[model samples]
Every structure is written in structure tokens, then in C-alpha cells.
Target: MQVAIDGPAGAGKSTIAKKLAAVYGMTYLDTGAMYRCIAHCVLNQGGNFENTDDIIRIAEKAAITFDGDRVFCNNKEVTEEIRTPLVSRHTSDVACIREVRELLVRQQKAYAKDHAVVMDGRDIGSVVLPDADFKFFLDADVLERARRRKKELDERGIVKSLEKIAQEINQRDDNDRNREEGPLIQMADAIVIDTTGKSIEQVCDAMRKYIDGAKA
Candidate 1:
């Protein structure tokens, strides 16, 4: 009973996935955090990110563990640390590497082997869990997505210019779409849900109904 939620950043995939997992009494896996953990390590060690080989080695040696909503890197709790702007910029770069993607995708699959898991990421449906019992691709307009992200950052007391944030997101979208390995894409069988004006609960309820029908 795996539910794979694939979507771009700030589309509420994380919030929806967590609620969905709780509804199903399943663990929630955030695949992006795995790359963030690796990127954090590489940056912390003063390694050159441009050197893909070094990043790969760092990724292979790093140990990232997800326990509930918490994330541990090398046995140290780093759930919040990896979400910093520095790590955010580097994570997609790390995720683009074939070796790292293979490693993390394997880890993600292993986490869902027991089933009854809710996993969310850009490529979960198209790449990681194509056969998941329920698959959904969440999306929203670019401006709406940026607004959501701005609100989250505002809550954290980290103020970023909207112009800069929009630029970054657009660039990321391009890279995510063009990446050779596990690019962000909508699977043909995925149920596309536009979340432009919907609240988190509204989106969750819709998915719940879909899941219930599938189960029925």
C-alpha cells in the first residue's frame, strides 16, 4: 500500500505526504532530504561541489537516517540543518549525479519494501515507485508555488527577496527537467492534481477520497 506523491518544490508534497502517511498509518519518506544530507556533508567538509567525483564519494560515505520527522546524518540529528539555503542550493546538484541518484533511489525503494509507506519527491512516481498503489502528481502555478515558499521562509524568520526566490525556482525547474537521471516528470498513469488555490487539508481530502476508491 504505497502512495507515491510526485511534485515540484513548494507544491505541498511534504505536508500532504505526512498527512497521508498518518492517515494510512505508514511511514513518510522524504527522498529530497537524503540528497540534502549528502550535500550538507560535502559543503561542511569544504569539498568542491563542482567536482562531481568528490561529491559522489562524500555521498557514498555519508549515513543518513530518517526516523519519523527527524533526520540524522552520521548519527547526529540534522533535520533542520539540511534545510538551510546553502544545502538547498547544493542538494539538486548532488541529486543529479547518477551514482548518488542510484544509491538514494535504492535506499528509497528499500524503505518502501515493507509497503504501507507514503513517499514524496520529484521523481517518486516516474522513477522510484512506478507501481505504487496510489500515485499522484501535485502541481500549482509558478507564482503560487513561490508564494507558498515565501510564507514558509517568512515563518522561519529568513527573509529572501521574492525576485531572487523566483529566479532560483525557475533555474531549478529547468535543471530538474533536463537532468539525465530521474528528471522530474509526471508519470502517464499519475493522477494530476492542481493545488493552486487549495488548502493543505483540501488537497489531502481529495487524495484520501481517491485512495479510498482505489481500495474499494
Candidate 2:
């Protein structure tokens, strides 16, 4: 079955999606990683995020592929490159560009044509996979999201204070919601799951229960 999980930053969508996908034998696609690749490539080319036309051109020429958890851009392993603070901050800008979103959204939809995938991103359910067999919107409070994001950065050797991370997370939330292209809004049919105060297993169990209940 095709599953689309959409949510704000640091909501644990990727982790939950991967585990659930493994349990059901579905392909796990991280659309955020695709945007990160775009951001990384454009920055490498010295392209500015404010240059919409240039960013669109760069995105059109970008080729991204994933091997398990690793990501590649134009045949170069960029898994670590894209997670840098520079790329992380600009990834949302790339995602918000209409033409950039058009290109990646097309690619994301094509993947679903040949495989059952569990795709997670800001607009997966609302735009990329509206007819997904299962749709979920996972979210948590800003503080919790900030804490999770800080931990992710710390593990990668990128040090940033909680207050700074929280500010960036909040700014991203505004950008995602206000963007004209594929704004991050929950779909009417999506199952909203509040992930605050929940462990990974607890969240996964809740998702699996939703599937079982729906199928029954």
C-alpha cells in the first residue's frame, strides 16, 4: 500500500515511516532528502537561494538517488553534505520554489507508479500523493520539535543551541505554511497523530493500529 506521511520539521516522520515501511515491505522514500540534495547542489554551484530562476534551472538539472539511508546527487554521495547547516537552512527555500517543487513532485509521483512506497515530506499527502492508500500527519509542539532537532544536529557534530534551533524550526513552520507552492497543510482525510511525549515504538504501534483498523 502507498503511505504518505506529512508533518513539520523534527516530528519523527522519517523514522516512523521507515519502520512501518519495513514491517509492511514497502519502499521508504524521504522527499526531504531530495530537497536537501537540491540545496546542496545549488550551493556547490554558488547559486543563491534568492535567485528563483537559477534555483529552478539547477533543480531541473539535478539528479538524486537514494541507496538505503544514503543519498546521492549527480552520482556523488551527498548524504553528509546535505545535512550541513547551510543546506538544511536552504532546503526549505528550494522546496518552496514552484518550479523546483514541480520537478521533485513529478519524480516523487513517478516512484509511486511502480512501487508501494512510504513517502514523508511537508506536502506528501496534500500534493504529491493525494490518493495514497494511507495518509498521516504527525506533529508535536514547537519545543519538542526543537529538542529533537537539536539532538539530531548534535549527533552529526553540528553544535547549535536549543533557542537557536527552536527559532529556526518556528521560521521553517512559517515558511512551509505560507509558501504558495505546496503549502504544508493537513489533508481532510489524513489521520492526525500528536507525537508529543511518545516513544518511537509507541508512535509506530499507533500507526500500525490505524492500518489494521482501516483494513478490518
Candidate 3:
């Protein structure tokens, strides 16, 4: 069974989905990582990010792979490189490109075709896997999300003011929701989980209940 997890930035979709995948012995696909990988490549190659044609060309030729949590670009490990503040900002911009989303969506679909996978992204449930066996929309208040994102960056020794982090989070939400190719939205059938004030294990347990019920 394929599980689609969709959420806005800092909603814990990736964390929860990774745990769910491990619990159920499913393949975990970090769709965001794919976009970030492309973004990393674009910046490294010094391409004009505003040039859609150039961006798409780089995306199409990108050789991206994942070894557990480590992301490889052209056989070079860039797991840490893609998570930098610069690439983080660039990823938000690159993620909205129509051609980029199309290419990744095709790859994401192919991954789910023959695997029991747990995939998470902004548009997974609503666009990438509309018929997924299980779907979830995880969310939290803007402030709470900003806090989580700050903590994540802090762990990487990247410090930024909460106000600035909040601003970036809000901007990303707007772009993900307003983008033309695959706007982010909560699907009707998806189980909505408010992740505010909840621990990772708590969220995973709540999701587990639903996965268990559905399988029964």
C-alpha cells in the first residue's frame, strides 16, 4: 500500500513519514529532497534561477539518488549541502516550476508503482498520489511551525531570528499554495492531524491508529 503525506513547511511530514515507513517496512521517498537536490545543482552551476528553461534543463539531467537519509547528486553526497539556508530558500523557488514538478512527479509515481512506499511532500496527497491507499495532512500553527523549523536549523548550527524564520515559513506557504503546477491543499479524504504541541512519537502513534484500522 502507498501512503501519501502532505503538509506545509515545518509540519513534521518528513519526520513522521520516515518513522511510518520504518515501522511498516515501506520505502520512504522524500520528494522535497529531490527538489532541493535540483536547487543545489542549479546554484552550484551558477545558473540563473529565474530562467525557467535553464532550470528545467538542469532538472532533467540531474542524477539524484538517496542512500537512506543521505541524498546523492551525480554520485556525490550532498545531504548536508542541500539543507543550507541558501539552498533552503532556493528550493522553495525551484519547487514551484511546472516542468520541475512534472519531472519529479513522474519519478515519484514510478517509485510507488512497485513498492509499498510512504512519500511526503506539499502536493503528495492532492496531486502526486490521488489514489494512495492512505493519506494524511499534517499541520500546526504558524508560530509552532516556525519554532520547529528554527530548532531544525539550530541543530545544523545555522542560527536565524525567529521573526526571520517565521517570515520565510509564511512566504513558502504562500508559494506552495499559490503555485500553478501543483498547489498544496488538504485532500478531502486525508486524515488531518494537528501536530501542534505533539511529539514525533505521538504524531506517529496517531497515524498508526489509522493505518492499522485501514489494514484491518
Candidate 2 per-residue lDDT over residues 26-90, each given as its tens digit: 99999999999999989999998889999989998998999988898999998888888788889
**How well does candidate 1 match the true structure, expressed as C-alpha RMSD?**
0.9
Candidate 1 local lDDT, 61-115, one digit each (tens) = 9998988899999999999899877788777898899999999999999878976
For candidate 3, which ten residues in a row score worst on lDDT? 85-94
Total clashes for model 3:
0
Decoy 1 TM-score against native: 0.97
Alpha-carbon runs more than 4 Å astray in model 1: none
Q: Which lDDT tens digits does candidate 3 get at residues 1-216?
A: 999999998999999999999999999999999999999999999888889999999999998998888899889999899988899898977888988999999999998998999999988988889999999999999999999889988998998989999999898999889988788999999999999999999999999999899788
TM-score of every model versus the real structure = 0.97, 0.98, 0.98
Error (Å) of candidate 2 at residue 206 is 0.2
- Candidate 2 similarity to native, TM-score: 0.98
